[model samples]
Target chain A: MRIAVIQFPGTNCEHETLVAVRDAGMDGEIFRWNRPEQELSEFDGYIVPGGFSYQDRLRAGVIASKEPVMATLKEEAAEGKPVIGICNGFQILVESGMLPGSGEIDLALAQNVMVKGGRIVRRGYYCGWTTLRHESLPRRSCGSFLLDGGALLQMPIAHAEGNLVTAKEGLIQELADEDQVIFRYCNSSGTAVDEFPVNVNGSTENIAGICNPEGNVLGMMPHPERAIFSWQLPPPGRRPPGPGPGRMVFESMRRFIEVSR
Target chain B: MRINLRIWLKIPDAEAATVKNTLVRRMGFEGVIDDVRRERLYSIEADVGNPWRLVKHIVRELVNENKEECLVSIDELDLDDGYVPVKVGLHIEDGEAISAKNRLVRRLGLSAVKRVERSNIWKLYIRSDEREAVAEEIARKLLINPNKDSYEILRARARAVGMRQ
Candidate 1:
């Protein structure tokens, strides 16, 4: 399957994401934002990789969201093509109103506010390893299609605006009821805690990732491509040499595309 | 009393240029908007005797004398005409503003500083007759994300009645 790793001006992770896609047995290429919009239709799946697009001029992802390429990406997504947005890519999707799939701005990934013990501990840019528990069932979402519910995967999240917040009432509850809440920040043992370091970015209800109602579009704050191999894993690596937990996300996208066809 | 510090870059503001470009070229505000300029507004609520002396210290702490220009006013914001000044600030907890308040009080020993509110003033020079309506549309569309931010249209008011420096 041909996958497009979309790149904006400041998108730094496109290369690694393309690497992860190829390693997952999918043919992939870095798709620039300035590219012809119709050319994007040739790709089977799309991945909006992370970076500070437009140098986060107006805000992270907002400027990039208004681009014409994103409009075409939305069309591709409507065709049930798997569209995975990682980190700033997630912000773009949310800003573009693609994550909720409502074709309207429904939520925002606000500034990171790290809270612990009912007090603000830290705020702003943070980069560190974090664990994500796949909250959706197997095949429920394209990005986590192969991951079973409650499956814990370790990944690194580096961002300043990963805090998911919604002013819309009952939206979080609605997402939960629809099984659209895909990944949640969790402890090593897979408990979705609501505290700093565990909850990570103080996202609503510890939510790290979410999918649209159709499950084709998934937006997540963590960087899965950063953990595609055992060698990329954090220190104290005693396990057998193999693909890392993050490989499943890409692999699952491939599988989802194949199954859809 | 409130100390309002309106700070703008002495150099060309790339952020404002980008916003103007995005709004005009991308979001289809080409004809409606003539230009977009931005200024950082810091409203510090302080109870201090010899307010002028205290403001000097506050300016020294907050305003970078190089590559930035500041206009100090007290009580009211007297913005220039020919543009609609839209004030955008985080409706949710603003950590930066909180930090600024703490810095002035705890670190700088400006104990009179009771609060500090920070906001971006987007000065939109609009060509449309319905300036306020267009400004609001632009604010909702491109400026503020309603989830965390809110915007206010700062209409022209009487000049600063308290003090101006």
Candidate 2:
């Protein structure tokens, strides 16, 4: 399938995302979403890469969502084309209104385990670019993939505002009711955490990603692009990162496009 | 992961309101409901990241040197009300924290305490008025000679408690 990766000024991970897509052996090109008349029809799907768009000044992805590219993508996504928003990309999708509106998710401010311990630990992680050793990340990330339910994925995260928030009601049921939630944050043992560390980002029901009403658009905080290699899987001494179910998310989308032809 | 004491204070006053506002702005919390009540009551209420450091900073601001004589006047009021301005203890979850935390507890002659991971927070707890003494102790340890910085921290801490409001 022909895929286009949106390239914005602060989007640093577009190239890596492109690498993952290309390595998967699909026709993929990096497109600077700002260029005029950037036709969405030129590609079958679009991938929004992650990074500190507009410096995350007024909340993550708040600015980039207003971009011309998002405006176009949102329209096309509504018509049934696939769009994937990752990290900052996910934030952009939410801001752009491509995904279901969060209205107001009560956020809980907390710190990364790394910050508390004064160094990075292999066990616990949250957003940003870092080498992830996962046998289970794929599973965590994909467990909620496009499923439209609030859940948690043991996915790696690296953002300062990675905390999850909900407004009005319990965000889990709301998202699940719409089938808008796509991923959740769970512990390594495939269960959710209790209180303190549940869904590291504090996402309700451990949700890590969510989808639009149509389920054609997915926004997630984890980096599935980082998991393109098998060697990166967790070590043998560790129970092994387990099967990366999230990979199938991309693979399935690619297949979905292929079957349409 | 490793700590001696920690705490998470839900400040209730204007002093805390100012600091809370500053923090919200600094943290870049956008679309927040602007107001001391809404701003102070941030939507993203989560566990305290570093309870000890958090309290220590608050103590520093509370004890910071400032001309806002009300804090000292409060002491006089305490005396007039028949209460000695002795120090109070602030239970901490982590012992090894910013000097401000240790300084406040030690300086005020307040006992330092700890809790196991099962507790998930600081082991010590201090009464209302004693917050000043513990905060002053933290400032002294930092060698902020004038005690101005210490009082600022204390004011900031008490503000959250609604005491300095």
Candidate 3:
């Protein structure tokens, strides 16, 4: 399968994403945001990677969400093509109203607000390893290849505004009921928790990632592509032998493409 | 017509204390800077002929009415037919502002100081009189984020050829 990694100016993770896709035994290439719409149709999957697009002006992903490329991405997503957004790319997806299947912005990845030393603090930007647990819903998720639901996966997250919020109260519950909730921050035992620094960014419901209702689009703050190799793990000695936890995500994406074909 | 635009956080102290404390504690500069409050401001100076119409469009497209408050004022520049300048200030919520102020005042030892307001300023210049549409488009598309901040049109007035004489 061939994968297209979308690159917006200031997006720094496209190369990593491409490498991950190639490591998974799939053909991968970079697709600039200004490229013609026809070029996107040739790829079987797309990935919007991380970084401060448009210098993250106004708000993270706000300007990039209005870019011309998103129109085509939205169309492809509607056709059941897999699209994954990571970190700032996730912000763009939410800003563009692609996640949760609403096509309207119902949620926001707000500034990271956490409790430190008994008081609320804006952690500004955070970078470190985190544990994630997949949601255990009967419905299939876009990225669920190598691991079962509730399995603990260690990943890295680097961002300033990653907290998830919704202006309308009680909407998070609706997302859960719809089986759109995907990965969540959890303890080592794989128990999802609402406390920090586990739920590092204080995302609503400790959400680390989510997929659209139809399961073709996924948006998450953690950088799974950054952890594909066992050597990338924190404290090299702690890494288990063989592939890293992040490899499963790409492996799953590759499997998803193969199955779809 | 000329217009000045200002965009800011809805709460005056939204950016206060947060950065100063971090700078003082994390960066090891406890006493170097006595106090600091960060604010964001957007200034739009346009030579568009239709000030009111432009203001209406800008308010609807650029400002977030639900999260922020905006005010419009008229400018009286001495020059005739000169562009009206619009100033927009962004602020956060009232309670958050007060709490931030209290934290800064107590921690920074600023009893003698009256007020500390910090903001960011963005200036937009419209050079063409006939291309008011371009100016309006810029304001609507690039000026602000409707999610958490608000803006105010501080002043707007039409420039007349007679005023130049």
* Candidate 1 TM-score restricted to chain A: 0.98
lDDT (CA) per prediction: 0.92, 0.47, 0.67
How well is each residue in A1-261 modelled by candidate 2, as lDDT tens digits?
788898876788888788777765677988886676357767888889888776664346755655667768867776677788887887777656565543222222222332213332222234442221222222222222232222222234566544444433555576666656555555555555533344454444555667665566777777777665544444424445434434555675676566545
Candidate number of the best DockQ? 1
Candidates arranged by lDDT, highest first: 1, 3, 2
Model 3 global lDDT (CA atoms, 0 to 1): 0.67
Shift of residue A117 alpha carbon in model 2, Å: 17
Predictions ranked by DockQ, top down?
1, 3, 2
Task: Let me know the DockQ for model 2.
Answer: 0.03
TM-score of the B chain in each candidate versus the native B chain? 0.94, 0.19, 0.34
Docking category of candidate 2: incorrect
For residues B44-126, write the lDDT of model 1, one tens digit per residue.
Answer: 99898667888888888888878788888877788887899999999988999999888888998989999999999999999
Stretches off by above 4 angstroms in model 3 are A238-240, B1-107, B112-165
Candidate 3 deviates by what RMSD? 13.3
Each candidate's TM vs. the true structure? Answer: 0.97, 0.53, 0.70
lDDT of 3 at A177: 82
Cα-based RMSD of candidate 2: 14.3
**Best-performing candidate as measured by TM-score:** 1
